[model samples]
Target chain A: MTDQASDLQEAGGQPESQDNETAATEPGVPEAAEKSGVSGKEVVLARDVSKVYGSGHAATTALRDASVHLHEGEFMALLGPSGSGKTTLLSILGALLTPTSGEVTVSGTDITELTSKEQSRFRANRIGFVFQNFNLVPFLTATENMLIAAQFASVPKRQAQDRADRLLEELGLSELRNQIPSQLSGGERQRVAIGRALMNDPDAILVDEPTANLDTKLGTAVVELLAREIKGRGKAGIMVTHDVRMVEFTDRTVEILDGVVCC
Target chain B: MGLAWKEMLRRRGRFLSVGIALLLINLLVLFLVSQLTGLDEGQTGAIRALDSDLLTFDAGVDQSLFRSSIPVSDVQEAEAVEGVAAVGPVGILFGTGRTEAEVVPDELFDMSVFGYEPGSPGEPAGLVEGRLPRAGETGVGTIDETVKSDGVEIGDTVYFAESDRPIEIVGFVDDSTFQLQPTLWVELGTWQELLAVVRPERVGSEPTANVLAVDVDPGADPSEVAREVDSSLPGTETVTVDDAIAALPGLSEQRQTFFTIIGMTYLAAAIVVTLFFALITLEKAEQIGILKAIGARTRSLAGSVLVQGLLLAIPAFLGAAAVTVLIGATLPPELPFAIDTGAWLTVGIVTVSVAVIGALLSFRRISRIDPANAIGGTGD
Candidate 1:
C-alpha cells in the first residue's frame, strides 16, 4: 500500500486519463488489432433475443424480440423499471441464459452454440463485470479477491499480480490492497470491483448498477470514473442500472419496458 | 478458475467448515478401506501358506484339522491316485508348549502343532526372517509375523505337549494361524512321540494322521483326481484348494461383516460431505450469481468446488491412516489383523470419490445461478 494508491488520483496531480496523453496512438489496429479482444465493431449484438420462464399460462416473458448493438469505446446504459426485464437482458448478454429464440454475438462470435469450455473462455478472456453489491470476496485481501478471478481466466500468476498492481494504482487503491472487502466502505469496495473487472484489460465491461449502494454524491463519482477510464481504454461499457442520476455520464442510453427497447 | 478460488477464500468460515468436513469424511473412508484390505491380506496369506492343490480327511471331519483327524493310511491312498503327484500327511494336535525349561508358566504358550514333510507338500509359503530347516534337525517353526510382533524368533525353543524334551529352534513361517492362534511346526516322528503319552492306544493301533496334503498333476482336473482318491479310500473326504480355503467355517461371515461395516461408513461420509457443501452453496447464493454475471461457465464453478473437496479429502485420509496405524501398532499379539497395499489404494480412491460426490450439491447451485441476479441479488 502506498500514498498515491491510497488516494484515487495519480501521482502527477492530474486527472487519471491525462496520464495517457503521452501514450503512443495505435492506428491500423483493426478493432481486432486492438489489444483488448472485446468485439470492436459490435461488442454485443442481440437480434430478437427472447426469454420466457415457466410454462404455458404461467410462463412469464422476461425479454421480448429485443435487439440492441453495442460497440467499442462507448459508455451506454440499459435503463428501465424493476419489472422491465432489463436484468434479464443483461443475463442473456452475459451468456448465462439461452433465450428461447435469438442470435447473440459477443466479440464477433455467436454465443448460443458455444461449448461449455468456450463459454468459460469467453467469460474469462473478453468480459469484465461489476455487480451492484460490490461482491468483493469477504475472506481474501482485495488483492487476493482480484487474483482469484484472474485465476479462472487462467491468467499467469505473475501477470495477474502485475495487472492487479497497475490497476489498483490507477484506481487510487494501492494502500487498501491488503484490506478485506469487509473493512472497506461501499464506494471503495465498488471501486475494487471496478479494478477487478479492468484487471485483465478486458474487451468490454458489464456493470450491473455500479453505484446502487452509494449515496448520490459517491454514485456520481463512481460513474464518472467508469466513463473516463473505460472509454479511454477503447472498450465498450454496457451498464444496467435503475438510477437515472448515474446515466448523466453516458454517451448513449437505451431504455426497456415490457421487455422491449424503447429509446 | 482462480477467481472462484478467491471467492472461496474470501469467505473463510464457510470454506473451512466445508473443507474440514470433507477432510474428516475422506479420512474415515480411507481408514476403513485399509482395515478391510488388511483382513483380505490376512485371509489370502492363510490360503497361500498351504501350498497344496487338494486336502483329504475322514468324512465326519469338521472344517479344519483342529476338530478332526484322518487315518495315516489315507495319505498312502491319495498318493496312489493316477493324477496325484505326491502326498504328505499333516497332523494337527492341540498342545501346550513352553518357550523355555519352566513347568507351570515360564514362557509356556498353548499351540496346535501341524507336522509336515521337511522338503515337500504343505510347506509354508514365506518366511519373516529365517530359513526352513533341513532334515537332520527338527526345526520347530512358528508364524514368523507373529514371532516378530511377539518378540519370538528363530532361536527360541519350546517344549511341546506330552514331550519332556525341548524341540530345537529352527525356522519361522507366516500365515499358519487357525481361529487367529498361530500354529507351530515339527517333524511327524517327533510329533508322534509327543502324542504317545496323550493317547497311548491310538499311538500304536492307528498312528493316524489329521489331514492329507496332496499335490496333483498340473494338467489334471483337480475334481477328478480328488474323486479318484476318494474312491480308493471309502468314507474319506477329498477336497480341493477351493473347498479348504473358501469353505473355511465362519470365514464367509467374517468377510461379509468386514465389507458391510466399511460400506456403511463410506456412505455416511458421502452424505456428510454433501450436507456440508450444500450449506455453503445455500449461503453463497448471491455470490454465485455474481460469478454467473461475470460470464463464468457452470462447469468451471462446479469443478472449482470439487477441487476444494479433493483438497480437504486428502488430509482427512492422512488422519484416518494415522489412526489406523496407531490402533494396529498398539493391538495385542493375538489379533489377526492383516492390512496391506491393496487396502491403502482403495482408501484413497474411495475418499476422493466421496468428496467429489459430496460437492455435487454445488452443481445444482451453479446451474441455477441467473446472471441477472448480479444486478440486485438481494432485491433491495
Candidate 2:
C-alpha cells in the first residue's frame, strides 16, 4: 500500500482545479435523476467489482471490491502503480473482460448480465478505447482505421466514410488521412487512434496511457487535445496514465492501491 | 471486405509472393492434367474410334491385347454365336516405316500397323485425301495424317523395316494414331506377310489375330453377347471396346502414376496455402486483437482473412488458366499433350476450394484472440 501511494505521488502532480476533489469523491449523478439543467450525466457505473484470475493455488486477485463512476463531459484519470488492477477495472467497465462478481452499467444498460456476444456488441457500439501504444492497425491508412470502428457498428460505407473524414479533419489529421500508421509520427498516430475510438460515437472513451510513447511536449499536447475532445463532445472519458503532467487535463484523479480504489 | 482489400493492397509484397506461389502450383497442375489427357488420347484414340461394339480375344489371356491370339476358327465360332451382327479379324503389330528419299532412323518413324479386311468395321474411317487398301492387296496401305509430318504422303512408297516389302500409300486418314505411334491401315494379307517375317514361329500353321472386333446387334446388350461369344467359342474371351483400351500394355499403370502425381500436387498445394495463411495470421495477431477490442466481430475478422485468401487464389487461378491455354495452343502437334476443358474446370474448382480450406486454419486463432490484451499494451 505504501509503494502504491508512492507510485501515485510520482505519477501525479498537485491538484490544479477546484472541482478535482468533488469530482473524485462524488461522481456526477445522471441528468434524469438530478432534475436540474446540468447536461452531464453518469455514463458508467461499476459496483463492488472483483476479478480473480485462474483458480486454486494459481489464483491471483487483480481487482477487489472496487466501485467507480464516470460522468458525461468529464475526464477522470486512473492512477496506480504497475499491476495495481487499474487496467483490470477499466477492462471490466469497457466490457472487454468479465468480472467474477460485479454489476457494470454503461449508458443505461447493465452489461454484466449480457452474454459474451452481446457484450462484444456493447463494446463496439457504446465503448471506445485508446491504448498507450496507439495500436492503430499498421496496414490501414488513417481514414481506414477510423472507418473500421464505424464498420463494426454496421454503418453504411458512405456514412462511415463521411464520418471518418469529419473525425480526421476534427483531429487535425486531414492532411495525413492517407498515411499508414508507419508513415505517421507518434503524436499523429495517437490522434488517429483517438479518431478511431470516437468514430462509433461511443458513450464513454477508455484510454490506457495515451501519451506513454510521446515526448513531454507531444505528450502534453496529445492529452490537451483529448481533454478538449471529451469536453467538446460531452462524452464520458476515463484515461489511465502513469505520467504526472497529464493529470492537469483531467477533471479528477482516482488512485488505486493493490486492487482497491483509494480516497 | 474493404479492410481486407486495403490490407492486401498495402502489403502487396507479401500477398504477391503468395499469389505467385499459387500461380506456379496451378500451372504445374494444369500442365499435368493436359498431358494426361493428351497421352490418354494418343494411347487409345484408334481403339476408341473403332466401330465394333466388343472385342474378343483368346480365353485364358487376361484381357491383354498383346497376349491374345484369336484363331480363325474362333472368329468363325464367335460370328456364329447368337446376336453376333458382324465379326472382323484385326491384327495389330508394331513395325517401322521407311522411305527411300531419306535415311532417317527407323525408331523415329515407328508405326502401329492395323490390319483389316476391306469394308470391315475395323478399318480406319474419315480418309482426308485417299482411300483404304483394296481387298487382298499385298503392296499398298493407308497412313494416318501424322505420316505426312514424317515426309510420307499418298502415292509415296514406304517399306517395312523387317520385310523390306514396298507398300504404296494409297490414302491419308485423319486422327488415326494408336498407342502413341502413327498408324498404318494395311490389307490383312500384307500385315500377315510382314508379321510372318518378324515372328515366324509365333504365326503357327494357321493365321491368327490379336483381336476379333465383333459388332453386336443394335438391340442386344453387348456385355451379354460378349458372354455368349466367350462361352460358345471354346478358346476365347470377350470384352467391350473400353475394356480393351484399358487393357492396353502399360496404359493402366501410366494412368495410375499420373493420377498419383496429380493428387500429391493438390495435397502439397493445400499444405503450402495453409502455411502461408497461418504465417499471415500470426503476423496480424496484434491488429486482430485491436480490431476485436474496437468491436469488430469475430465473423468479420475471419471473413477478412478468407477474403484475402480468395483475392490471392482467384487471380492466380486465372493466370494459370491463361498460361495453360497459351502453352497448349503453341505446343507442337506431335507432342502428346491435350488440354481437356472438363479436367481443367475440375482443377480450378478444387484449387479454390483447397485455398479456402487452407485459410480456415487461421479462423481458430482469430476467434481466440483476447480483446482485453489490446488495451493493456501487451497483445503483440
Candidate 3:
C-alpha cells in the first residue's frame, strides 16, 4: 500500500485493509477498471505544478510541486484544510489561474500554454465547474442558468435548449425549470448548478465544496449524485472538500497540506 | 442579451428609480427645446413673416427695430437702387390694448402696433380673417389671431393704454408676433398718428418709419442689393431678413445659454448612468466572477451592460416625449409652448448615444473582475 493511502486510512479511522466499499484506487485509474482488473484512459494530468502569487520579498507561494491526475470515470476527492492550496491547484487545472511552473493536460489540450481567450473557450467546452455556494445567476431561471454554459461555448440556441431541457429533467428539476435561484431551495439550487456544469457534456468536472451550505443529509445526497454522474457518464471529476465523510463518495482521495499534494 | 433583459424585467423595481431620473432629464431637455422654439417664434415671427427680402435700419441703432428711426424717403432711394423691386416704411409702437367694454378688467393684452403700406413689402402675409386696411385708412388695424384667446374679435375697438387712442380690429393675421407680443397691422397714417400721440418728440421735421423693408427683384442677390441700399442711404445698415432676425437683441445669447444648460444636462445624465451602472457592477461582482469562470467573454458582458442601459434609457425617453406632448397640449397658448419633432428626435438620438457611452464607461470594472473569485479561498 502507498504511504499516502496508509496516512488517509489512519486519518479516516478506517480498517487496515481497504475493501470494495472503500475503493481507494490509483490516482488516474478508473474505478471500473480496478474492479475488472483492467486499465482505462488517463483523462486529466497535472505534472509538477507550482503557483506563486506575488514577486520579490512580497511573493507568496500558494502551491508547490503538486502532481495529480484522474482517469476516465474516476471521481477524486481533493481533501485539504484551510489554505492548503487545494483550491489553487483546482483553479490552475480549471484554466482559471496560471501556474508558475506546470504542465496541465485536460482531455488532450495543454491548457497552461493556451491564451486567455483560448483558455476560456477550452473551459467552456471541456471543463465544468460547480461552485461551493451554487453561484447561479440570481435573475436567471434554472433552465437559463443551465443554458448559459452552452451559450459560453457558442452552441446553437436550439441545441442548447434541448440540452438544458435534458439536464433539468435528469437533475430532477424539470418542474422548477422556470424558477430563479431565490425561489429555489438550497438543494434545488445546487442541482441547478450541477445541471449547468453538465450542460456542455464536458470531459471533466470540478466541484468545490458542494455541500457547504447544505445539511449533512442533503450534502451526502448531492455528493452521491455527483459521483453517480461522473461514473455513469464515464467522465473524470475532482471534488475539493475538507469533509472526511465526503471523501468516501469519491473513487480516490488526494490529500493536500501546506501547499503540497499527496496522492 | 437575454440574461440582461431578464434581469431588468425581474428587477424592474430597482431599475425604476434610475429610469425615472432619466425620464425627468428627457422631459427637461424636451421642455427646454420647446420653450426655446416658442421664444424664438414669439420674438421673430413678425419679422420672419414679412414679405420683403431685407430690412434697412439706422446704422447707429445697432439693428434694434424699435430704436431705429429712418426717414420715409429712404424707401424711395432703396427702391431706386439696382436689383431693388420695391421698398416700404415700417413703424412700430409697443403698448397694451383692452376692449372698450373692459370685460376682463386689469387683464390687459400686450400688443405691438406695426404700420406699413397695406399692399407693400412690409404687409402681413397671412391674413386669416377680414380684409387688409386701405392705403389711406386710419383707425383700422389687422390684429394677430393670438388676441382671439383674450376675447378680441372683428369690429371690436381696442384702446391703446399709452396713447388713449381707439383702433378697430378690421382683420386677423396668423403667426404675427414681435418680442412675445401679438401685433396689430395698420396703415402708415394710423401708425404715425399713434406714434405721434405716444411720443411727440419722435415726430421730427419729416415723416419717419422704424425701418425700411426692401424687396429684391427676381434673380437678384439680396445681399448685393442690401449693400447698394446701405451705400445709397448713408447712415443706414441694410441686411437680409435672416441676418436681421439673427441680430435680434439677446436672441443668440439666450439660445447659447439654453444650449449650454442642455449640454450640461446631457453630461449629468451620462454621469448618472455611468455611476449607477458602476455601483451595480460592484454589487454584482460575485455574479460577474461566476460568469467569467463559466467562460463568458468580457465583450459579451460589456454588451449586456450596454443593452441594459439602453433598455432603461429608451423607455424613459419615450415616456418623457409622451408626457411632454401632453403637457404642451394643456399649457396656456399665451405662454409660447411649442413642440418641434426634429428637436425631440435629435435629443432622443443624443440621449441613447450618451447612455451607450455611459454603459461603456463601466466596462473597465467588469473586465477586471477575476474569475478565481468564484472559487475563493474558502474552497481551498
Candidate 4:
C-alpha cells in the first residue's frame, strides 16, 4: 500500500489541495471540505450534507456532515473503502439525489434546493455521471448509448448525433458504433460509457469507482483517459475509488474516512 | 416508438399473451352485445308490421296466444265506442307441409297461419311473393319465399304438414310474426270453417274469435277509447298497442335474458384489459424511473403508458366487431337478431370506454416512480 501510494504520488499527475498539503505536512486531524483547498474552485459544494433513511433509532445514516467542492478543470479522486459513502457522495455531486439538510451547488446552482423540474434541467445541462457497473443500456448500440445521454441533455437529435459521433471517435471507437454493450470488450465498453458521460459536454463528470471491474493495466488506462480528456475539455471530474493507483492520473487526492476527510 | 412501447413490443411472447387474452374478451363482448341489441330491434319490427292499434282481450286470460276468445260481435261494440275507428276481428293458427321448391317446410319451421277479415286494420302491409289469398285458395307466409331464401314463390301450391289442405303461396310482408312464428295470412271467413263449428249450448251463434283490434280516430286517444270499449264488454281487457306487443308469447323475456348475458360479457372484457395493463406497469418500474430521472413529465409518461394500453385494446375491439358480423350473418330469422346502426354504435362506444378505463391503472403506477430510483440509487 505504501509503495503504490508513493509511485501513485509521483505518477498521479496532481498535487494535494493547498490545505491538504498543509494538513499532510503536519498530519492527524479531521478536516471539513472548507479546510481542504483540494483545488477549491467551487464547481461542487455540499454544505453540511446529511442523508438519513427510515425513521426512529433504526434509521441508517448514509452520509453525515458530508461536504465537498469540485473545482473547474481539476481531476479529484475520492479515496475510501467499501460502504464508505463513495456512491452516496457521487449521487449528491451528480444532482441525482437531495440531501436531507444543507445544499449542493453545481455550476453555481444549488441543486438540492431546486424544484424537481429545475433539478432535472440542471442535471441535464451541467452534470455527467459514470457508474462502476458500466451502466450503459444493454439494448442500445455504442453510438445510441451516446445519443441517449444526449437525449436527457435535451439536445436535438441532429446535434446530438454530431456530438455522439465526435465523442465515439475521440474514444477510439468510431468503428464499434453499432455494437451493443454486451458485444463490446470490457475496456471498449468502459470507453463507450465515458463517451456517453461526455456526450453533452457537461460542466463536471462524476465517476463512481469506474475501474472497479478492470485489471490494473486497464484500470490505469481508464484513469489516464478520464483525467487527461476530461480536464482538456476544461471540465472538472470527481472520481470515487478505493484504488490507490488512480492517484497518478488525478489533479488532487482527497482522503475520506468515515464520512469525513483525513488530511 | 418510445422506449416503453419498444420494450413491451420487443418481448414477443409477452405481447402475444396479452394480445390473445384481449382478443378473446373483445370477441365475447362484441358478439354478445350485438345479439342483445339485435333482438330489441327485431321484436319492434315484428310488432310494427302487423299495422294494428288497440286490442281487446278476455279479462285476465293467461297471455296473448292462450287468450280466451270473445264473440265476432265484439268488433261492432268496440267500433261504437267514442274515439275508436275501424274495429276488426282476427284469428291465428299454423300448419306446414311443402313449400314451392319441394322443401319440407315442417322440417324447417312450424309456419304460422293468420286469418284476418277483409279490410281489416290488422292486415300485414305487403308481401314478398304472389298476392293475398282468395276465398277458395290457400295463402303462404313471406319468410319462406324464394326471393327470401329459395324457390318458395307466390302462386305456388303448398300442402299442410299433416292436414290435407293445400294453399297457393301469397304475397309476403316483412316482420309478420306472432307467437315467435312467421305468419301466413288468410281471409277471416275461410279460417272459421277450419278452426270452429257450432257449440252445443250456443247453437247458431258465431263461434268465439281471438280479439278485436280497434284503430283510433286520427286525433283520438286510443287508450281511453280502449277503456270505454272494455267497459261496454262484460268480460274483457283493454290494452294499448305497446302493451299488446309486449304480451306477445316469449319475445320480451328472451330479449331480457340476452341483454343480461351481454352486459356481463362487457364487464368481463373490461376487467381483463385492466389486469393486463396493471401487470405491464408493474414490470416497467425501472424504465419508468429512468424516464423520471431524465425529466419526463408525469402526465406525458402516464399518457404514453395509457396510449400503449389503448393500442392493445383497439385491435381487440376490431376483432370483436369482425366476429359479431360473422355470427350475425348465420342466425336463422327465428332468432330475431336485429343487427343495426344502434347496435354498432353501442359496441364502438363500449370499446373505447372500456379501453380508457383499463389504462387508468397504469397511469397511477407511473406517477409514483421516483426519479432517484431510476438512477440505481438506494431506492428499490
Candidate No. with top DockQ: 3
Better candidate number, 2 or 4, judged by lDDT: 2
- Candidate 4 lDDT at B148 equals 46
Give the candidate order by descending lDDT: 3, 2, 1, 4
Instruction: Give per-residue lDDT, candidate 1, residue B25.
Output: 59
Model 1, span B198-255: residue lDDT tens: 5565565677777788899989988899899889888778888778766677767777
Top-lDDT structure, candidate number: 3
Give candidate 2's error at residue B49 in angstroms.
2.7
CA error at residue A259 for candidate 2, angstroms: 1.5
DockQ of 4: 0.19
> What is each predicted model's overall lDDT from 0 to 1?
0.71, 0.81, 0.85, 0.66
Candidate 3 lDDT for residue B306:
94
Q: What is the lDDT of residue B265 in candidate 3?
A: 97
* Model 4 Cα lDDT, one tens digit per residue, B1-380: 35546555656577667767777776776666666655554444434555778777888785464345778887877778888878877665554445534555444555655566766666666565456655445343334331245355666665444444556665766656544445666677555644543222322357556777678899888778877888988788878778877777676887678668877877887887787778867876765675555445677677766776667777766776777677778877556555566666776678767878888877877787876664334311
> Of the pair 1 and 4, which is ahead by lDDT?
1
Cα RMSD to the true fold for all candidates: 5.2, 6.1, 6.3, 8.2
Worst 10 residues of 1 chain B by lDDT: B135-144
In model 2, how large is the Cα lDDT of residue B223? 98
Pairs of residues clashing in candidate 4: A11-A248, A12-A247, A12-A248, A17-A38, B38-B338, B96-B161, B127-B172, B128-B172, B130-B154, B146-B150
Candidate 3 residue-wise lDDT, A103-150, digit = tens? 999977888899889988988998899999999999889999998899
Give me the TM-scores of chain B across the candidates.
Answer: 0.81, 0.88, 0.90, 0.78
